[model samples]
Target: MSLPPRAHQLHVLACHACGMVLEDALDSTGHGRCPRCTAVLHRRRPNSIARAWALLIAGLLFYIPANVLPVMFTSRLGSGSDNTILQGVIEFWHGGSYGVALVIFIASVVVPCSKFVILGLLLITVQRRSAWARRERARLYRLVELVGYWSMLDVLVVAIVAALVKFQSLSDIEPRSGILFFGMVVILTMLSAMQFDPRLIWDSEDT
Candidate 1:
């Protein structure tokens, strides 16, 4: 079956800012602006795949240390123990703080791991130009963006709990290097998502 022509092939560009449609030539520089809204119109983001790949790899590198190192230290009386993210979740679960455990598990462990997998899949399929499940892949990319907004939930929970416990005479909580690494993973993954161009999924191919 023959596919219909794409808007780019017709030289029609829509303004992302104001929905203004304009006809322009695609060039090496992708230099042009929407006359109504003055928004830069580009066929694709420059270095989109390259930038996304770099950020994704950096996030993966930090993922290991983020899981292995102690994310927090809890000192009760004169003794203390180092708790990695998983250990903290386990502790909360055993201590009957089920809700807190579930929240932390989802935000800290599940969400980040899912982002790594989903982002990797998108990058791989786009590079391969695989037409399989194009719509599903696009939806996964959107899912990545949506979850990013809550990526910091785990970090914020820790910070809030630490602050609240600071007033106690015998108990105190302190963040560790793992939390910092995890924070970096979150930031890098979010940036990676932003760097990716979703339009690439439907370009130069027919579904």
Candidate 2:
């Protein structure tokens, strides 16, 4: 069976922000401004793979310290304790809040790391002009885009907990440097995914 032609064959590009279709699309450097919303248009994102790799690498670098350092500091009657991400997850598991623990572990650790891996693979394959599994690769890109934002779930939880669990002298919960690093990880990975242009996956003639 013959497959349907892709949008690129028509020499048009869709505006991501406003869904406007511009004909004769050739603004790859993002200099062409969209007439409707004034958003810059790029046929293919400029330096997409490189920018994505940079952000992904930064996210990975931050991931280490974020897991090592304490994300939360707690004090009860002047006695202070620090808890890292894994420590908190384990604590939650031991305390029988399995659902929340699982959610945190997946959202905070698995999602971001998997996103990095997936995006890295996509970039490598696109650069090599691999014709293997073009449709599947495009699906993978959509999956990455969908889940990238969810990595922030743990960060939001931490912020909310810190906000709610405050006490003057009896007990207190405050965010530490680890969560800040983790936040950066989430943000960087999301940005990385956004910077990646899925159109590159099908750039080769065979694809």
Q: Could you estimate the TM-score for every candidate?
A: 0.88, 0.90
Model 2 residue 77 CA deviation in Å: 3.0
lDDT by residue for model 1 (20-63), tens = 77786557446788778778876677799999999999999999
**What C-alpha lDDT does candidate 1 achieve relative to the native structure?**
0.86
Where does model 1 exceed 4 Å of error?
1-5, 16-19, 26-30, 167-169
Model 2 ranges with Cα > 4 A deviation: 25-31
Q: What value does the lDDT take at residue 114 in candidate 1? A: 96
As for candidate 1, its clashing pairs are none
